[model samples]
Target: GGKNLNDHALVEVLANEAKNGIEWLKTIDANLSQVGSFGGASVKRIHKPVNDEGKTVAVGSYLVPKLTKAAEDKGVQFVMETAATELVVTDGKVTGVKAGDTTYTGKAVILATGGFAANTEMVLKYKPSYEGFVCTNAPGMTGDGIVMATAIGADTVDMEQIQIHPTVSQETSALITEGLRGDGAILVNSEGKRFFDEVGTRDAVSAAEVAQPGGFAWLIVDNKMVEASSVIAGYIKQGLTVEGADVEALAAAMGVDGAALVETMDKWNACVEAGKDEEFGRTSFANKLDEGPYYAIKVAPGVHHTMGGLKINTNTEVLDASGNVIPGLYAAGEVTGGVHGANRLGGNAVADIIVFGRIAGQQAAAYAN
Candidate 1:
């Protein structure tokens, strides 16, 4: 059920740490709930968190506040509006970080700043082919941590392996979650024909969409799916969805061939009812998209994740060009590479950040003590 894309040792470390991470979340009062299968996962192993009202909240949104509150309660001072300009190295060991004119000295430093997907120039420097691609990253994901670490002789890995998510709304640059397709949404081209399996991996689906005539597609879902997923409901509230009362109406609204869409919807509902996708060889099935009042979101590929950053070991210790650990320097999340290898599967990024973020904290603390 697992893709052997990454180093076996790294994957094993992630697998082991993921368990501890989930347990740690529970200890910190994270509201984790049922496990769901995401794209590229054969089993339902991705742990999702729900709010107190039992509404599914995006993992990052749910965890960030909880972790922040927990850390703040423990007297962790959060330095806001300060960007790290450099990493201070004392005798080949990282000792602190410099922000503007201020140097915050410490025994150990953790570079938790995110990836460079939002940095157009940095992204183009690594992968020139991604030019003109809309990024789904926040503006702050400018790889400042990576620049600081590299300036201090730290090495990076997989810098060119940036990931583009398939379902991103160009209008808002908002990432339409993969859960929509997993919950029974279908992607159709301008011709209103299903071109590929909607549940395929991000890279595969993105490529398929790029191959289409307009390099984009429409994700169609019925009211049933909207009711079943709060994520989709939120998308609608964000004005990212184009709604219609029926299949023909939705296709018309999407500027696709209405008759072709009707036929495609008929075939899709049949496949859902029969528990088989004969055309695309899709095995995963959810509720049929036959309910009235369908919604269509115009989506295309957008730069989502940079699968590379500062090279780090299993202990989250950042390494140098000679493959030696930079003592007292640690990194995690999208700032570190080798965890996801080339293509990161959905749900793994969350696991990566939580698992390795905890490890980096512990290792840095240990080094400091």
Candidate 2:
């Protein structure tokens, strides 16, 4: 729903900024993913010079493997299932988190528990119209960090600016990663017409796709698109996709008109030849749906992740509104604000967690000493 007309332009600027002089990152972290630029919520924006399909390669080759390895090599002493009851602040400096009767004493406790999108009551209290909206996040995210942070003074930004992914399975409402459509999936309505441009940001593309004739649109792809050879196929193997034999059969099952699908495909094939999308203005498409028994899967919007939280300095230190750094306190990951600004790109969240997690850990641990 949020459109950035300058998204592609910004990406180019950031890319140029990197290619020329990027030593700041090298000084901070060596094992970081070598991104040419940042701030694309989807690959289509980042690789504007390439087709939507190539972005999947960018993620699979560059982002995922690097982040996964970095996280494994630098594993935090994670204490899972432990509730952070309250921030133990003494004389206005956060020292630790108190959970149940036990105390987690540290120089700082990074409250990266994520947002309250999972909590219906909290959503209603803060963002009312978004209530009853089902959340796919862990059900335990009941504004605990927000509440706890508020009790001790923490500022949040863009609380109302929550972005929803469009391609959600209507029944289960699981978030279909935007990467699938990035790798050449078309969205079909009940009429079976290709409805939206699949090359936009995840949230915007999802909204456009599902807003067609169907209350739910099936994300259609070919066997070759999500086959074992496809980078997105790995996710399908991980139980993320629903496939069909052909487009007509897919339409029949999803209550889409088969004839409309044939017509839609004809026009789309024409556009694919022209090398430009007429309706959606997508010049960056990777593959055609020419090879398949086509596929269509259900989709809807579910809360992917929150983009707002405690304010932090560039060094990952939590700071108050008055530009005063909170002593004995640090933050990282999704809890730390301002890296991605209003919205975050797909792989960047993982990047933020890893890069800032190290800063928070080292700083917090050192401060503890």
Candidate 3:
């Protein structure tokens, strides 16, 4: 609604956590590489340093397994395939979790079960308007942590706020990645008009997209942007992209106005030439949309992130409904909310997970000791 930074303190925390995360990754010998950047906010991607047939290599491939082995070496036991159904609380303190008729007691408990974007019922319950909208979260992201924690009176905040990404595929709804726009792709509507700054924040860009003639937009890029970026390669390999010899052909293929597309490109180039985005005030003009063999992908606001869950304080301690810290209960990662406020900027999730997760682990360990 306004230009001021909404979650300024949280943003600072995330930024500092990013530095801590990089140091921790180095300590663990994580096979990380900077893949690309996104938004005028200039967030970068960190992924495994491998070319796995052009597919995105998730952290589970290397990072998670290593961490698991380390934890196992330290006598940490993992209960496989068990769903925690409730928190076992006694005398105002959380003792452990109840899973399918068995209660696993612990000195302290930490919930890292992620957000509820994949649960359609929860989506409908919180955001009824997105009943039929596509979600880009894992199938198991069903708000299990929120349910269990709240069962013990954990207070949840901003439970209704969800983030809609600007560039998810029309066919498979796979995320096209904000890194594409960060690397200099432009968003054009059905009228082939540049509706907003292509590199604007996620919420702003998504809001502009859903308000277009159709409830979607098209990300247009040149051969240079396509070749310089890895995200497009995956999309192209999956047959989710449309290509043309030029802007006219691209617009025709996308069913957009060809002349308008040309004019929009002209104006965008002029903005780049002027070293300023006069139209929408985007700060990053990394590349000019001036190369041909143009490419495009249809995109809409897909449900990507939830900004709400069990509320926690800066110590990563989960709080109760009465604003008191829940004794022996710690939460981190996507399971706890109030870090990103209304809209999470791109790439902040990784920092949030690493930083607060480390904090939560330390606090839990101290509590146990």
TM-score of each: 0.96, 0.77, 0.87
lDDT of each: 0.87, 0.60, 0.79
Please, what are the lDDT tens digits per residue for candidate 3 over residues 188-299? 8888898888777788888888899978989888988767656577677888889889888988898888899999999888888888887787766667888888888899
Q: Write the residue-wise lDDT of candidate 2 on 1-369 in tens digits.
A: 123422243234334443222233343333233233222333333321112344334333444444455556777455667887788988778877898888887656766666666767755665575654557666776668777876777766545555556766656656565656655567767667766666556666656754665456777777776552344565466565655577667667667677898788777777777888888676556567777666666776666666666777655666666767778777766554455555556655555565566667777777778
**Per-residue lDDT value at 219 in model 2:** 74
TM-score of 3: 0.87
Ranking 1 against 3 by TM-score, winner: 1
Worst 10 residues of 1 by lDDT: 1-10
TM-score order of candidates, best first?
1, 3, 2
**Which portions of model 2 show Cα errors greater than 4 Å?**
1-77, 229-243
Which segments of candidate 3 are over 4 A away from where they belong? 1-12, 31-37, 40-80
lDDT of 1 at 184: 77
- lDDT per residue, candidate 1, 2-106, as tens digits? 245465677888888888888889988995676776677666677887655565568878888899999999999998998889888889888988899999999
| TM-score attained by model 2 | 0.77
Cα deviation of 116, candidate 3, in Å: 1.1
lDDT of 2: 0.60
Candidate 1 structure, TM-score to reference: 0.96
